[model samples]
Target: MSGNRSQVIIQSKRPPLSSAAPVKVTTPSSVNYHFTRQCNYKCGFCFHTAITSFVLPIEEAKRGLRLLKEAGMKKINFSGGEPFLQQKGAFLGELVQYCKQELQLPSVSIVSNGSMIKEAWFQKYGEFVDILAISCDSFDEQTNQTIGRAQRGKSHVENLYKIQSWCKKYRVAFKINSVINTFNVHEDMTENITGLNPVRWKVFQCLLIEGENTGENSLREAEKFVITDQEFQDFLDRHQSIKCLVPESNQKMRFLDCRAGRKDPSKSILDVGVQEAIKFSGFDEKMFFKRGGKYVWSKADMKLSW
Candidate 1:
């Protein structure tokens, strides 16, 4: 599935931005929040499990929304195991509408795989949303089949094209994101994607996190999908016309740069187990630990007190 499918929210309420905000989002900045761990595609470069698990209960989400509204947060980004897959998306859509009409919070956005975003999903929330990020790694049919999204019948390339076309018909702006691994690291791939249309292209560098980043893991049947540096560089050179939207606040949106996970066990959030690690975002990032193979937030990882 798509990695970093986490939705980030604006910390304050303001007029909707017709264009992106000043690129440089700095520390103490709250940009994205992971909504659910459930996803359809298992991409090479992913970090969903490291951030969240299960869906945020509807009641809990309501409370979260109340908090956001009180805090004056206007814009909220929706993401998921295909955000449209949520059991009762209308509630989420309603939340967006509340922000748009009642609170007049600028705009809401959703990032999805676009497998089958039925008319109901968009009709109910499209007006409230600013954009829909459709994941399109490559325009190659073989590549889509190899990437494990083949069972969906239609080629990933065809689905992506349809999404772009529909967005145009609906008068919505869309962006395209791709994660790079050692497998598809060859040139001419991204170039092919850019050659078609002037879409926003996002390239993610593969990270060595959880399970296996290098060696081999039985879980990852598509290990050959890793993209190489030279291939990536050549494609970037060829597609100079494409817009690269690397967020200033997050270079690695889905994958955290945990280089320490390589040499030391304590450096990685996943390595320390969900139970014993520190928890961030209202909880201590280090307080997460594993119990019965489940990662749960146990205690707060409090820093030294003055």
Candidate 2:
């Protein structure tokens, strides 16, 4: 639900940052592995099929995770309907612990809808995680309800702040992922997102999948949410003052292989090896790395003293 909420242009008297020491680029970048499809919210524009099912067993899931590391993926982001929705993140924590402690992946992260996350869970496993990305589409409650992201009687914005504080306390880099669609494309989130100051604000255009979110047999209630590329850009233009803005139009989003069933079909790491699966899926390797898909922005790696 997070859009590139804001952008800040810092005008300084000092020299430009390009004069600083060169950054070491991590090779064999990252991949988004949709470990589960069980999510709480039923957003109309969502392209991922919402399922009340769990596929891989714990041990088998871990084996697949290790295979992904062996395939040269430095960062493995666990995504789903919501990664934190399972048993108060018990099963999710085990996977996170395994990736960081056993497989030793450089970056381990998750994309979640912040409602089910607890402070206790963060205290136990937060150190092992690199980033916690919350999907927050709108700051307005009515808009959220219209978009199907309401947290029952609770407020999503409130949960976001609480989660942000928890992330700060546990030293996990916080990120925001927003999908811009018709409902929220015109909303200005500068004041709210600027206050949060997340490390990254990933904004994506709303997309329609052939059989998943659209078409005759699909859950296509999201046609009302689709926005044109120009309209999406207009929204970004309105929030140019917010920092850490990374905008992805539908064209760019299509090239990201991790987005299940986008341009190429999704393949499970358990079914085929990571390399073979990515190869078969036609993931844009060079583009993926170039888009800052993998960076040394992990709070554990940076040790920011906030």
Candidate 3:
């Protein structure tokens, strides 16, 4: 493989797809692809923990994305361990360009810890990415450290501001995702969040996922981060004045329902195609729409002045 653009491809062995037709076909209007399960941050309450370091070959990944686009996928959110960590953001930049320029998808976005993103990455891939959702659990520096969101020699808050500025400079819609836990549930982030002025501020309640954050197979012990539903609601009530605030708790927001306490591994879309693989995704289509999953996702139609 080429050195300049190729990522470390650790392919997972999979069984062959069945020839039988699927009973139902789920139109994947929006999908999240956790391309790599490796991250630099040690966030205690992360549901999608670093269980494996495997990332499919760049060509195969692009092929899978093409399949999704052909299968009615409108929006594709590239998430990680950290999407930028692979090949120092080159891997992600290529995928973003493919989804927007080649596939002509309406929306291509990424969810990342702001630390790894640099101004140069934005310069190259900013136009392709509709939204950049940075994970910021707390405004307080000390609180962030307690939540394992702090990097050793860097200030998470400062990096957040720098990224916010870059987003504005590049005309990318900036967004924030905060997981309200015991560390930040009582803290009022009204002033800081409002000052940043994100197009959307997604406030999520700390959730537990078996084999990821909870149970025996988990990498992180997130029980300490858990809070009651009432606490989450109180936090929302406090931030009610923030017009862009979008609150999502365990009950209301989930692309896939793993309430059964164990998530069964499903075949890769590359192996079974998007139609068969999506059936086992446990995606809740109704709840996805109810929680305002769909909106003006395309940056082209957003009509924002750069």
Candidate 4:
């Protein structure tokens, strides 16, 4: 989880609005689309686990992107159990290209495990991508394996470096996302993170969603991964030298009220329209901005030397 995670009770029924009262509108400014829930890595604290193998057809997915762009969406982030899992990254590449090329969104990005990405995928879709955030929870090989963040034989850290190099070669701004959990809370990542020198290092506190990781219907048991706030803070203090660090606390991530013990399904934007579908999202625009969610996200505007 790259961002903060929090749980809140959402009122299932609200009083009817007066005919004269204006309907509440939530802008689709920066949207994280969990297009697919299937991932290769079995991270113990993964809130969005593989519950289904379904992926929306490419053309239909594009149609929804167009609707979001029309509804004032500036950034479109493609996330998943693993986005690159579909068609060996072609599905994600197409969406990234469409959002940047056709829809002309300011920012198009993906959050992936970094193991499935190959040079070929970036070769075709690199130019259109603004950012690529890779999830790397620990630099220690054994710790990563214990946390289920590693493939049987491949080194997750080495793969991370290879992906970082690809990001630089492709001119895509690189970012690192680490979920601080009990296993790697004490590991000093200062040396490794400084060596990578990503544009941003997003440090997230391990979070548990009701039906995703903790409740009866959950797929993963995340209680073992949970760390105290003080532990998370100590880890942050240790990495004070990393200038690009961005910390996200579980409490600060309350923009969305994930009530129903899981992410409640709403009518597809393709069928009901972006405006109608987004109302059910319960997005707090003010809190999003307050959390430093907006920044210089466009690659062209970043002015970095490729």
Query: Whole-model lDDT, candidate 2?
Result: 0.73
State the C-alpha lDDT per candidate: 0.48, 0.73, 0.81, 0.81
Candidate 3 — worst ten consecutive residues by lDDT sum?
1-10
lDDT per residue for candidate 3 within 1-306, as digits (tens), equals 101211211111122346685444567777777788789999999877776677878898899888878878888888878888999999999999999999999998899998889999999999899999999998889999999998987899999999999999998999999999999999989889989999899998888878779998789999999999999999999999999998889887544444475455555666666666655666666677677787888878888777
Off by over 4 Å in 4: 1-24
lDDT per residue (tens digit) for residues 62-125 in model 2: 7766765665656778787677776779988998999889988888888898889989999889
Per-residue lDDT of 1-306 in model 4, one digit per residue for the tens?
Answer: 111211111111222467886775555677788888888899999988877777777887777778777877888788888889889988888888788778889988889999899998889999999999999999999999999998999999999999999999999999999999999999999999999999999999998888788888899999999999999999999999999999988866655434544566565776778677766666655566666788888989999888
What is the C-alpha RMSD, rounded to one decimal, of candidate 4?
5.2
Clash counts for the predictions, in order: 34, 13, 0, 0
Candidates' TM-scores? 0.64, 0.85, 0.91, 0.91
Pairs clashing within candidate 4: none
For model 1 the TM-score comes to 0.64
Q: After superposition, how far is residue 98 of candidate 4 from its true place, in Å?
A: 1.1
Q: Alpha carbon lDDT of residue 152, candidate 1?
A: 54
The regions of model 1 sitting more than 4 angstroms off are 1-30, 49-53, 69-74, 88-92, 187-199, 211-231, 244-255, 258-306
| Runs off by more than 4 Å, candidate 3 | 1-24
- In model 4, the worst 10-residue window by lDDT is 1-10
